[model samples]
Target: MTRATFEIEITPNETPLLPGVGRFDFQKVWEGDMQGRSVGLMLSAGDPASGTAGYVCMEVFEGTVDGKLGTLAFQQLGTMDGGNQGLRYIIVPGSGTGELEGAIGVLNLTVDEGTGEHSILLEMSSDH
Candidate 1:
């Protein structure tokens, strides 16, 4: 399998859910921005690697999922790449289901033939 590598740096804006949560490191997938799109993002996240403590990382974004703006739809694809600890998860676009709730966590991604230097931000939001 083709392996994509990434150097991910996350700046925590809030730690209401995690008290000791600070800057965490992740190796993610580089899925490149889609053509003719306003923004772009890559999937990333993982479990506590020695010091970091959290759940599996999972997300789908384009530029920004939330903002000083209004409701925006982040189309989450079921397939993506990259992460350590060997776990799998996804976020789809819709409501009334069990996954698209208020619950939030990290998103780890990996892609084929990607490397560090590629980056994106994963912001939080509600399904409604």
Candidate 2:
């Protein structure tokens, strides 16, 4: 398994899916064992002003993992309630392309409260 860390930048998009919902597009720059970038879209619902919300996101990542160049797709599910939060990123089955064919993994994310910096820890492996 390889562990890679990354920093993310999210931008709100003008596309509105529904009232009281938010749509955002994001880009991530990965470092450490994986060097690359990922582009994704996020859809969020619920009340963020009261610290209760949920979101789903899909992203396609293109980059080098363990020196292998390819692209992989991920789906993220997350929720926040008051001071508590939960998030999970899963690799889409059969969504790997190029050198990442047959890739499998899980990703975890953490945000620095003081700095508001977004980071991810990807635990990844490939069957190819």
Clash number for every model?
17, 0
Q: Which stretches of candidate 1 lie over 4 Å from their true place?
A: 1-9, 18-53, 56-60, 63-84, 93-108, 111-114, 117-128
Instruction: Encode model 2's per-residue lDDT on 64-85: one tens digit a residue.
Output: 8888999999999999998798
Candidate 1: tens digits of C-alpha lDDT, residues 23-75:
32232333333111222233333333443223333333332132222222233
Error of 1 at 43 (Å): 14
Listed per candidate, the RMSD to the true structure in angstroms reads 10.9, 1.8
lDDT of each: 0.33, 0.87
Best by lDDT: 2
Residue 116: error of model 2 in Å? 3.2
Looking at candidate 2, the ten consecutive residues that score lowest on lDDT are: 118-127
Which lDDT value does model 2 have at 100?
A: 90
lDDT of 2 at 107: 79
